[model samples]
Target: MQNAKPLPSYLVHRYHGWKATTWTENRAWYRRLADEGQRPRAMVISCCDSRVHVTSIFGADQGEFFIHRNIANLVPPYNPDGEYHGTSAAVEYAVTTLKVAHVIIVGHSLCGGVKGCHDMCTGHAPALEEKSSFVGRWMDILRPGYERVKDLPETERLRALEKEAVLVSLENLMTFPFVRSAVEGGEMTLHGLWNDIGEGGLEQYDPTTHKFVPI
Candidate 1:
């Protein structure tokens, strides 16, 4: 096996800076979290985008949110196959064990994952169709979302499908028995969010309006 590499000089400097500031400032709270274990009240499923800061966006403190970031922030339909299901496992742990009161699917504008799905489905990215593309396979979850927006103007479909990613995830979350039970029994709630990367605007999905409204 290869040995782990050392941190880059710039990252090491940043780490030291944080350790002297934010970390030292919250040393006790951090220790308390480690001692008592995390009890986050919400679980956030978001994209793996560098600009999407889940915690900073909510002004949340440590242990405030249990976040799971994936490509396009999707949740697959419930499957009980004894295979590696990273997203599903996180959801199970968050809902059943953590007993989080809320599960939020947060999508964002100009998501490369969403773009990849768009390119892949539209015959633009042939490499994604191969069995070897992890991203392509993972993005397959958004295929249905892509279909829903296919009829729209090609120019407008990507943005529409980005929101659809959040909607699709909300629907898939219900496929899990525990999630469905908790949501239906009023013990837990589900939410969908779409964030504008450049504008910094946040929108919450409104089932009644069937649209994303400004938050």
Candidate 2:
């Protein structure tokens, strides 16, 4: 507790500004949302990258989206070993409780996590190869994705691996029984998206064509 501290001065100032403007203007809506709880239509699984603003990209208001951000925007294969599974828990809650109609996995260009996986798989990042590195272990979820794109030209491999992360997550998500049931029952849909941050371009995976087309 001794190390705990109040919000930083800059963040505090920003919060005050937002509270005076946005919060005050939407007080009634905020109150109603607090009273009724959230009923977001979609669950967005995206990377923890600070630049990837999911809500801003979609023009979503508060309570309109259930977003879960993690390294490389990954979803591991379902394993109920009584361990802590933040992403999986979020998925279960959104699917079973919130009953979101769609689950969207968003991957992005220049993802550090994806790069780490690439480096680790290629034996370029020795520190990440250590057993004690949390990020290294986490990025292991995308190892298979790296393998799929490792042979491509160095220039195109990163982008390809980035998209592959989305595909891997989409595939891993279906390994969950509840997700599979929901999709099979026509109660839910799954989507994979890749964002080109610099170009402000978005591409969506097309299952039929087996490609990502710009959107």
Candidate 3:
């Protein structure tokens, strides 16, 4: 038998076929969107992990949220001198330009990046002192996680650290002037979330509760 190529139906998205019907369903809404412009309601900052997909979890439509993904979902402290600042740039645009009402930092359990940080902390692996490792440097933002959860056992400790990293990123998001101003002005709210892809449960942070509860 000849080696057959994948079907066009498999390669081509079904959404492309639904264009006419989709537009018809929301014709008036789309007309207003064209006239006004896209104004997304929320902005999501999530990890670049292939296992954790933000769009599917949020059940978001295309124009509902602006998304930014980086290693471990870290939001670094704002600095003009830093050579790489793509994440910060995205946050600024979402908050200042798009004027999103919510900024969500979603982390996940069993993250490879977080596990790498855990390994470095336990001295199980050699310290990545060299600048040559791009991913190692990116994982640096979650370094503090190991120390903070060092007292607990490996399993529980790592889970706590993973959640802690989300909180840390939420704090880092506030360091940006645009984020801070929007938050202070009641224009935006910061949310820290953890998704357990392995188990299929969502936990959202609650300020008053000071803990994550199933949502």
Candidate 4:
């Protein structure tokens, strides 16, 4: 707590503005949500990128989606070794506790985390290759994905790797026993999505064709 700092002036101003406007206008809705608790129908796993706004993209309300954001939006394979697994814990709660009907993995174009993974895989990012780098260890989950698209041209490789992040997460999600059971029992469904930040384009993975199509 000694290292904690007060909110910046800009953020303080913005908070007051939002509280006076948005919160004031939705006081009843906010109170209802606080009393009833959240029962979001979907869980959205997205990147820690500032550009990727999950709620805004879906025009969702505050309690509509149970969202978890992490580097590269990657989900590691099920490893219940009693260690701290933030993403896994979020997924577990969403599926088992919240009983969300759908789980969505969203990747985005020009993702820094995905690019870091690509660079590390290609030996271009020595810093990320270090054993002490938490990011490097986390990104190891996407190594298989990088291998799949390493042969492509430079222009396409990054984009492909970005989409691969979503694919890899989706595949890893199934590794969780509860997720597999829920999906197989038709209690839940999984989805993969990619967003083009500059172009404002969104694409959904088509399992039937193994390709991404504009949605």
Q: Give the winner by lDDT: 1 or 4.
A: 4
Model 1 Cα lDDT, one tens digit per residue, 1-215? 58889899999999999999999999999999999999999999999999999898999999999999999999999999999999999999999999999999999999999999999999999999999999999999999999999999988999999998999999999999999999999999999999999999999999998999999
- Please tell me which model should have the higher lDDT, number 2 or number 3: 2
Candidate 3 worst ten-residue window by lDDT: 121-130
Work out how many backbone clashes candidate 4 has: 0
Model 4: colliding residue pairs: none
Candidate 2 total steric clashes? 0
TM-scores of the candidates are 0.98, 0.98, 0.83, 0.98
Candidate 4: list runs displaced more than 4 Å: none
lDDT of 2 by residue, 75-114 (tens): 9999999999999999999999999999999999999999
For candidate 4, write residues 1-215 as lDDT tens digits.
79999999999999999999999999999999999999999999999999999999999998999999999999999999999999999999999999999999999998999999999999899999899999999999999999999999998999999999999999999999999999999999999999999999999999999999999
Show how many residue pairs clash in every candidate, following the order shown. Answer: 0, 0, 0, 0
Lowest summed lDDT window (length 10), candidate 2: 141-150
For model 2, what is the error of residue 69's alpha carbon versus the real structure, in angstroms, after optimal superposition?
Answer: 0.4
The reply for model 2, stretches above 4 Å from the true place, is none
| Alpha-carbon RMSD, candidate 2 | 0.7
| Whole-structure CA lDDT of model 3 | 0.84
